[model samples]
Target chain A: MIVGVMGPEGSYSEKAAKLWMQKYSMSGSELRYFADIEDAFLATVQGKSDISIIPIENSIEGSVGVTLDLLLENEAKIVGEIVVRIEHCLLSKGGPEKVRVILSHPQGLAQCRHFLKKHFPDAELRSTGSTSHAARLAGEFEEMAAIASPEAAECYGLKVLLSNIQDKKENYTRFIVLKAGKKTLTEPETGSEKCSSSACKTSLIVYLEKDRPGALYEILGTFAKRKINLTKIESRPSKKELGDYYFYIDFEGHDSDALVKDALKDIKAKTDTLKILGSYPAFKTFRSVNIDKGY
Target chain B: MIVGVMGPEGSYSEKAAKLWMQKYSMSGSELRYFADIEDAFLATVQGKSDISIIPIENSIEGSVGVTLDLLLENEAKIVGEIVVRIEHCLLSKGGPEKVRVILSHPQGLAQCRHFLKKHFPDAELRSTGSTSHAARLAGEFEEMAAIASPEAAECYGLKVLLSNIQDKKENYTRFIVLKAGKKTLTEPETGSEKCSSSACKTSLIVYLEKDRPGALYEILGTFAKRKINLTKIESRPSKKELGDYYFYIDFEGHDSDALVKDALKDIKAKTDTLKILGSYPAFKTFRSVNIDKGY
Candidate 1:
């Protein structure tokens, strides 16, 4: 199996891909690195790679807008998900005191905003394409430091000047595993499958038809009336107008469930556009398996 | 009047701040520059600056996540809004063929994504703190190109190689004017106020008490039954857990409106925390004023 991700072999997306392979009991998987996230997703969608893992949200920064945009405009369906704990470390060839320039991916720099402000207030911040790329640059420059993972520091032969430098303590990122064929996930034919209806969650993209007062309320009622709980509800611009938007929603329950199907049917009839991104097994359900076994 | 914004001047935020002042017919306003959005907002909230202008969303890139997070965490209230047409340009001191590196704010780079992919695929892309800052660097390096506004090119003394390079032609960004006062907007004492209930919009942030199935539906019902329309409804993670979220909603109606008051009363009772950002005359109302006179 081939897995494509935004990577130079040490990015968070690469780590998520490996975690996903372990959870699914899959092996002999090969990893392909791409500098751009869009390019990575495109490779998978075009069948250049069998699967793609992309980060969708971070605890501190909220939703990854570009990733959400790609999901809305693409044919990829999420087959699985993994939550990776993020711990940003400052890495450089020279000591921390010698750092005059700081290079990182924009998000990486933002995540470590407080730490950078307090310690290196005068350092010039330069943005790189990826955290791994930043580490590569840091390896060649003595006056430069990079905010990246420990793996990146190791890969580029840099020293970890400071670890766990992000602003928030409970920082985590959610990455989705996607396949190109389906618009929505359907029920499994076999009874031995782990992703049963109760353990899965559904994700959708919705756009309203007109400026009705209760249009959104009516849409929410379909899920509420059936006792379905929403996991997430985010809005993105439709690019057509200022106030207009495309709503992205993630909710509990799978397409195989009768109540979920009913809610989706009602939503499809009410909204102008309804795109089902996927129905995948919840990450918590998979994580608890090893925890329950005390491993 | 004094205005605080993310700037080195010639940045999009500075342009929006100026547009906001013009729309309000305000004079003698001086602009204060801050490297970070949070600091700009803090200066306003702390009364260091009379007002602060921050970009909230772009038509192509979606919500500015950091700004939304700040709005949720701070006590600042929205006093007005302005929409600025975004026109990105490729700037350099040298010719395009000699450009080996391109610098831009990530959003600037993203907005002009198609233009860059087709032309400068091999050029190294570097992220900067702001578009104007990118222009500053391009002025110093002959081999470097920058993606920024035309104003930035002029300010930094660089030649514009190409203009309107954004992926979409109708690219625009929305900026909100915020003040440090008011938890919720109340009716004005005099009838002379321009922001009457008819032409105003009230923005709110709501967090639910528990995971009830109909919690959000019930909250929306308050406005729907009152015939109030929602302009925008975006969700950001609460950062507490995976599925927990804080909903940001903007709807048409002023606080003085009886039906709007009714909805607010109900929403306050249904949710754990309800923060009213502000009630201000809609941007459309303000923009139409000069457009009607063909200016």
Candidate 2:
């Protein structure tokens, strides 16, 4: 199986794709690198790769809204998902004392803000294309250090002077593997037989009629009256006019479920546009808050 | 009057604050600068300045979420507001022919992404603390251009190699003049009397009760039924649990209006905690958009 990831040779997405290949596939498995998650999805759709892993959300920074926007606009379906626990480390060429500057992705630098504030507040902080790039840069320039993964440090032949330096210990990224059409992996609990049970999530994008009174309420009430628990609801501007919006919602039931089907019908009646983005496993295990370190 | 703005020196906030001082009743103004908007707010709350000018939102980037977060957390009240049209220029000392690198704030660079992609796709881009800082660096270097305001070019003695270089011509930033307590401003159109009419937009921060189901929808239903137009709603982590959130909402219409008052009453009954942040004029002006020059 070929896996698609984001890269310019060495990115976190590349590392993630490699990890997946090692854990679940063959040693000589094919790997494809796209400039962005969108390109990766397109490649998967065009049969370039079997699946593409795209980051959906992060703990500290919240949702990667761009990914959600792309998913809403695209036709790919999420087949499976994974959550990687991120452990950011400060890697230098020789040691911590030799470091006069630090470089990493802006998000990486922000994630480790508290550590930098308390320890290296005076050091010039620079941003690079990726954590891996930062690690590579630090290896080339002895005066520079990088905030990146332990795996990156190892790959770049760097020494980790600090570990788990992120501001929040619960920092994790949820990645979804997308395919052209629907497919299901075996349930984690029961791997004995081929079960026809569907996934438990119904993700949708809804655009309400302009200034329609009670439109949002009417759409949400359908789920409320049916005892459906909404896992998420985020609004983005339709980018057409002021106050115009499209809501992205995730509810706790399959689209085929009677209640969810009824709710969608109700929402369709009330909204100008409704797009069922996808229905897939909730991945509750992958979303558990992990706090293995202190601030 | 003493005005506080975000800067070490020569930031966009400084220019915005100066414009505000010139336009308003600050006949003899004392200007102060802070490193960030949060610091500006604190200085205002602590009586360091009569008012602080802070950028609340940008057209391309949406709201400056940090500014909004600080406003929610701080003690200062917004007294007046303004919008500044932003037109970024590429300033260089080495001429466009010699320029090989571009530098500016990440947001500034992001706003000019389309322009950069078209003209300087190969130019190495870097992030600086502010556009003015980038200008300063460009003044001392060769083969580099600073993406900043023309005002910054004047301040730093850099020549504008490319003016109106931003992707969107209608780029604008909404700035709020903050004070320690609410003070009514004289109506620009009718200076005869103090405008005592309640603010048209009502702002609220709400927290839902634990184990609540459909609480947000039930509360929002109140406004939906009353035909109130919610301008925006953003969810911030309550920092208590994995999925719990505190929602910040803005809706059109005065809270004193019968329908709005009734809606709030119903909402208060359902929400675990709800605070009226404040209400003010919508500030419906396109001062930041349709600019004729690169400022």
Candidate 3:
């Protein structure tokens, strides 16, 4: 099986793909890396790859808006999700004192801004395509350093100058797995049909036709009335206007659950656009192997 | 008399600051530039600057999380808001034909990704501290082109080779104006108190004590039932966990409005972290001079 990822080897996306494969007991999956998120996502959408994994959100940086945008634009269905703990390390050929240029992906650099400012304030900060790419560049110069995954040091033959260099503790990145072919969702049944998802989490996107008052509130009322616990709720711009938005929400309970089904029905009627992005298993918290429906 | 912004002279924040001053009829305010949102915001928070402007959200890129995070952490009050239209242009000392490297802030670069891929696919995309900084670099080299505001072209003696080059049309950035001092709130009067805000827009941040079922719904219900229209609603990571979030909501009523006041009373009771980021004038869309109470 071929799995597309948003970055080269040693990227968090690669780690998420590995974790996702392990959870499903699918071993020996071939990982294909792409330079950007759009390419990796489109590879899955166009069936150029069997599956793809992409970062959806980060604990510190917030939701990956482009990923959310691509998901909506491509009608991509998320089959599962894996959360990867991000422990950024400073890698270099020499010591921190000799580091004159600090390179990282924009997100990586932003995440470690406090650390960089405190230690290497004079260094010229540069943005690369991916954290791993920074590692590769750092390997070529003694004065160049990278803020990237610890695995990047190993992949690029560089020394770990400092470990866990990110400004925050317990930084986590969530990656959603997308399959090549979208499963055509049939009409949600009245709880008589068998549950398609063994997992308890469901995600959907909603876009109100107008930026009208009480439109979103009315939609949220559906979930509230059903007592569904939302795990995540985010609004990305529709790219049409400043106030226009597309909300991506994650909540507990499978779509097949009677309560969830009713909420979905009610929300769909209220919003002009409501696309069920699929349900997945709860989560595999980093380093813990335990997986359950968490009912 | 000092106004703070997140970037140098030619940045969108600078433009927003100018617009805000013009709207408030405050001429001759000094503009102080900060390197990042946190600094610009904290300048206002610390009273180092009387007022500071920071980008809150973009039509394409979505909410600036750090700005939201700082607003909540500092308990700063917003007294006004402005929206600046973003028109990224390719600027260089020379024409586009000799350009081999394209530089901008990460957001500017990301916004023009499609244009770059189609025309200058092989050109190196480098990131600088700000788009204006990229313009400065472009001024030093003929081979370097900057994707920046048109004002940057003038600031750095660069020619605009292309205009309106962002991936999407109608791009806008919403900036919230933060003031240093918090006003002491007397008990909210029941229709007896004069309205604190003349503008019809209000902004607030809420953190649910727990990700409990119906928690957020309950808050939205307060506004929905009162018919207070929400113009923008965004969720930023609480930075504690994956599912934990801080919701920022913008609505169409002054905080002094009876319905809005009641909603605030109800929402504050339900959530552990409910901060009224102050009510501000709705907005001054780019190139438009009309300002009203908007009620």
On DockQ, the leading prediction is 3
Label model 2 with its docking quality class. acceptable
**Best-first order by DockQ:** 3, 1, 2
User: Where is model 1 chain A poorest over a 10-residue stretch in terms of lDDT?
Assistant: A184-193
| Per-residue lDDT value at B186 in model 3 | 33
**C-alpha RMSD of each candidate structure in angstroms:** 2.8, 5.3, 4.2
Residue lDDT tens for model 2, B8-43 = 566787767766665554668888877556567778
Quote the TM-score that chain A achieves in each candidate: 0.93, 0.78, 0.90
Clashes of each: 0, 2, 0
lDDT of each: 0.81, 0.68, 0.78
**Interface RMSD, model 3, angstroms:** 1.4
DockQ of candidate 3? 0.69
Highest-scoring model, lDDT:
1
lDDT of 1 by residue, B51-148 (tens): 89888888888887778888987888887777888889999999999999898877888777778878988787776667888898899989999998
Per-residue error (Å), model 2, residue B25? 2.8
Write down the TM-score of model 2's second chain. Answer: 0.79
Docking class of 3: medium
- DockQ of model 1 vs. true complex: 0.66
